[model samples]
Target chain A: MMGQTAPMREAAKHAILILGALIVIIPFYVMVSYSLKSPREIESNTGGFFGAQAPMVDEYCVKVGNPKEDCLETPVIFNYSQAIKKAPLFRYLLNGVIVTASIFLLQVLIALPCAYALSKLRFWGREFVFSLVMFCLLIPVHAIALPIYIMLAKIGLTNTYASLVIPWTISVFGIFLMRQFFMTVPDDLIDAARMDGMSEFSIVWKVMLPTAIPALLAFAIFSVVAHWNDYFWPRIVITGDRDLYTPPLGLREFQGDADGSMWGPMMATATIIVTPLLVVFMLAQRRFIEGITLTGMK
Target chain B: MAVSSKNTGFWFVAPAVSLMFLLLIAPVLVAAFLSFTDYSLGNQGFSWVGLENYIKMFSRSTYSKMISASVTYVLLVVPLSIGLGLGAALLINSVRHFGDFYKTIYFLPVMAALLAMAIVWEFTLHPTIGLVNETLADGCGAWTETVFSFGWIPGIDGGQSWYSKGCQDSFPLWFGDKSYSMGTVAFIGIWQAFGFNMVLYLAGLTSVPRELYQAAEMDGAYRAWDRFRLVTWPMLGPTTVFVVTITTIRSFQVFDTVEAITHGGPSKSTYVMMYAIYEKGIQQNLMGIGSAITLVFLVFVLLLTLVQRYFVERKVHYA
Candidate 1:
């Protein structure tokens, strides 16, 4: 009786695990199924839980506004083509890449020195400045959006990419993350570098940067994802210029025009927009997860 | 640790600080000034109005509603997401096989891209032709239609096509309705956010010592609830506090989901304070009113964070 009960209990545990796993997997299944369904099938609501039909790109093309062409036959449908045709997705993507990369690059350039200063350099206001940066992290971006908008307008920088990119270049979160990572860098290493007559910048570039690769990569993933996924800043800064729209902003524009009605095309467009981030996340899952975990630890 | 005569550190920080000052700090000061004036975006200049915007905001009923909605959203989303995260973590931690796979699956939403998820969710929750309704129909036995037809629930019809002509007036538009809009937004918010919190919880849970559980079992407190209560809950205090604090802040700052899902629509039922500020300042170009709203939101968030810190820090167990 005892043996039977134990096996039953183990089976029950497995059942619960499967149930939990299903909850995580179901939405993704729905997203993929909906993306692959024909417009008529989607409209008819014929696709059941797992989708009745196999994945096809023709429906994806029709939804992306290419009625004349069917991409189902091709090995790769170039779904991004349909996406670009509908919106300046490529240009927007380019802008996003530039803005996000620039922000990350500038953050590294600034944060490495500041972090080194705080961790290595003995200064009077060092602790106070570090504390101030931490306090700034508490201030939500929205809290200062209005003020930032006015400041940019005054400088004749409104509607420019500078308005979007420059203001967000120095992230308090990035500074904090780097500082935490820098604190973990051994003091002995810095002492050795100094003993070798290396300047502070040289130490940071040569001795510290290579040692800080994991932290930098971790911070890079965080910075890229945050800025790339950002919509609020671009919405306010890049007004009335479709050419300047980022991916998130572009998706918003498409949704606004479609207005909660066009599911097929909207899903296709969404799939296009999401694929890059998903690809990036998959490629850098380790760093991304580590970055998030490290942030939480702090 | 001695201060060297070298000024390279100053130079390194100068560029960043100067940029931050020019872009972030300078704007905040201008915004503070603008809050006291009657400045609109289109207006060439501003006249000092001396707290008129603040006074106006206080007097408006809509602003009060917005404050309540934002508070409710934050309150509901923070604890719930954290709880869900903890649950997911516990489950994921127990996996003896394919542990990494489970982690990846749970983390999918976090990496899936928010705009895409929001759009997908919007369709999934569509009143008609949505997979949710179809699922409900299959599992719940057409209860929505029955409820609507039997007059069990007012303003909710199940049988009528949710998207077809002549159905717009009869069918319940989940996002388009004022009474249910915030609730809908909160549900989506929870769905999108729970995964991130789950990861944090998992990290915390993994760090818990297994010997405690073994000792609890030895003490004859081996029931699931008993084990969790006597060992896991106490050990997880710090992580819980951290999760709650961050989740609270995030909930207050929620913009992407709102923008993607509702745009604070259906008569501004979903209009949280941030959205209100954005609409007034950016879209409507009422810089003064927008600035006033932003200041109000800032004070509100600051107070909440302080109170939370005080409360949570007291409960956080280092061990």
Candidate 2:
């Protein structure tokens, strides 16, 4: 009876989990399917997974007085093309890359050295600095976004990439994460580097950095994914500047301009905005998961 | 050597410490001070309005609605997401096959940008053309209706069922209806957040000792339920605490979906605190009110984290 019931229980669990998996996958399925669909198919909610590849008239092209033959394009091509061409989708994606990359790079540049100092060097005020970090961790920057925005506006940095990137440059979480990681490195390693006449700066860059790659990679993933998806900060800072708009901001703008007719291109824009990270995540699933869950260490 | 090390440490930490003061610490102080005054950007002078903002926050109907919306959202998202996360984690842990597959599927939402997912969800939940209602519409007068209507229970009315009602008329305008808007936003929050919690719980589960289950069984907790209650639940206490706190904090910070999809709603049903801050502070230039909200938000977060720290220190450390 126990053996029989156990298998039945396992099957039930699997069935329930599969239902959850389906629910979770539905939007993604809708996103991709809608992106591949024509406006008519989208409105009517027809077209299977890939949508009918039937050529559709480009209303915009026709409005621009293009010939019917010139305006006709397949659903996938039309959706993707309009997604890129309708707005600066590529530019938004590029801004996303630039911002997330700069944020991560600056965070490491500022945080790695501080982490090393906090972990390895014996110094006065070390405890004070660590506790300061602990305190800063509690102050979620989003909560204080008003003051930050006002500061940026006062400094005439609003609507610039600097405003979007400046506030995030100091990641207390990154400093703490790297500090914890650096503590695990053997003291003999640093001492050996010191014996070879390596400057502390070089020791940090050359010796410690090599050993901290795994932790640094995880932090990079965390930072990149975060700033890439970040909307609130960008929305606060990048008012009236389309060029500085990150992916989420860009997608929001697309949604803002959308009529009922624009859902296909809008979804296409969403897919474009969202796909890169999802692709990177798929490629490095374990690392991405580790990077995300690294926050739970707090 | 020691002096050189000390000097290097100071130099190394100098930039980060100063940035921290400028970026993180200063903004918080600015918000705190500004919360007590009638200050707006570009204003030459301001008057001290001690506790006026807070007083208004406590008394105003809009502010009360904001507080209620935020509290409702946090209450809905945190518990439901944590429960679903723990459930998924436990199920995935117990399953002999395809565990990683389920985990990967579940975590996909976490990896996707929330704003983008929220937009996609908006489309998915569209009342007329949406995939969800369309799918439900397709199931009208079918077995799905039969099972969902609860008509088989002998006392329930089949024609009055939500499914049958939806089929007969239009489905609820998920984000358009004030009644369902907050729940829809919270659902999206749960959809995006639970995966992260699941990953954390999965990690916690791995750290639990296999021998504990055997030990519990030996102690007459023979059934899986008994063993789980005696062993698994107790062992997951720290994780439960951590997950609860983190999920609570994240739920509080839910801005993307609310802003992008509902725009604080069909009424103000989805007017979360973050949205309120954005609206009053930035858009309306009411820095004082925004700062008050910010300060309130910061205090709540600090208090919660402090509580978590106390609990972590006082309990859940079996080792």
Candidate 3:
């Protein structure tokens, strides 16, 4: 009787799990399917799996309405090319890469030493500085936007990538994350390195860093995803220059213009923008989850 | 070794500390100072007007609306997302097979760029061609021809055209109408953030001892409510605090979604304090007023954080 009950319970649990999984996956399935559908089919609501019929690719290509005659109707043929041509996609992508990479590099440079000092070094005001760093995390970025904008404007840095990347490079959150990871490193290793006549910087570089690669990679993923997805700061800073538009801004541009509403191209742009982050997260799934869990635990 | 260690530490920390001081601390101080002035972007100089900006902000009708909208959004999104997250975590925890697959699927939203996702959601929520409405129609048989009568049930043509040949006829613009925009925004916000909170809850749930649940079961606490109350709720206290605190702070700082989806309006319906600050300072060049609003928002968040810390620390049961 107990064995039978256990099986029944386990089956019930599996049923619940399957239902929950469907709720999460269905939206994503719809998104991907919509992305593949022709514009007319999307408009006519005929492309749905249970609908009248699956609209063919030709219907969507014509609806995509690329001015360039090079666009053709074939299986898997869509007007993504026209969408790319309409905007400075490569330039936006370049800016995103430059800004995201620059910010991540700078953050690591700044956070590593600070984290090491907080974790390993005993200083006069160590606790106070550490507390202040944590306090910084509580202060919402919105609170500083106005003043930062004004200050950046004063320094003639408004509308420049520096305005976006420079202020963002110094993240207290990253320091805190790195500090937590650094705390796990054995003090004996540091002591041995010091006894070998290695400088503190060298100890950090050779000893702490090699051991903290997972933590750093975790933080890198966090930083990269955060900045790449960011629309607010970039929107404020990168004005008047279409060339400076990030993928987010570029997609917004596609929507706001007189083309009415190009669902096909917009979906295409969205797909392009989201794919890289998806790939990165999948590739580093374990590390990403670990990083997130560690940060949340704090 | 000790002597060199101190010097190296100082040298190493100098760059980060200096940058933090300049970028984060200095601007906050400047913002505090600017709040008291009547500075505008057009003016080369400004005279101090103590409490004037604050007074003006309080007196304005629109400011109150913005505040209410933001508050409503935070109140709804934070709790709902956290609840959904905990539910997802609990369900996922029950299943041993395909656990990683389930986790990955749920986490997709968090990994996807928000800006891009917001655009996609905008498409998904479109009245006519959107998959949302289509799903409702086919799955539930719900339809409405009129905006006012578009109930959840399908097949009722209330004489509303969801999409017109022109751009003018899209019914119930989610971000345009003041009455419903905040709710719409909150719904999307919850969807976007539910995954992050779920992961956190999953981690917390993992640490809970199974023996407690087994004991409860042996004691005949087999009812759903009894099991959850006796076993799950107590163990989730720390995670609850963390998730709620972070979600509240994040909700208060909502700008990217508003910027991407609404631009703060069909009529400033979605304009939270942060977006207002950005608009006034960055767009309109009203530096002083913008700074004042920023300060006000800062104080509000700080006070809330203190309250949360007080309650959370008191209630947290650390194992």
Best by the TM-score measure: 2
Screening candidate 1 with a backbone cut-off below 3 angstroms (N, C-alpha, C), the clashing residue pairs are none
Residue B173 displacement in candidate 2 (angstroms)? 1.1
Error of 3 at B93 (Å): 0.6
Each candidate's fnat, listed in order, reads 0.54, 0.90, 0.71
lDDT of 2 by residue, B1-319 (tens): 4579888999999999999999988898999999999998899989999999999999998989998999999999999999999999999999999999999999999889999999999989989889998888888888998999888989899889887888888789999999899999999999999999999999988989999888888889978799879888888889989999989998999999988888887778999999999999999999999999998899889899999999998888664
Listed in order, the DockQ scores are: 0.52, 0.85, 0.56
Evaluate model 3 with DockQ and give the value. 0.56
Segments of candidate 3 deviating more than 4 angstroms = A1-27, A49-76, A258-261, B137-173, B218-220
User: Where's the lowest-lDDT run of ten residues in candidate 1 chain A?
Assistant: A73-82
**i-RMS, each model, one decimal:** 2.3, 1.0, 2.1
The lDDT for every candidate, in the order shown, is: 0.74, 0.91, 0.76
TM-score of chain A of 2: 0.97
Candidate 1: residue B35 Cα off by (Å): 1.9
Write model 1 residue lDDT over B259-278, tens digit each, in one string.
77888877777888878888
lDDT of 3 by residue, A109-128 (tens): 88888899999997666787
How many clashing pairs per prediction, in order? 0, 0, 11
- Candidate 2 Cα errors over 4 Å, as ranges: none
Candidate achieving higher lDDT, 1 or 3: 3
What's the CA error at residue B261 for candidate 2, in Å?
1.6
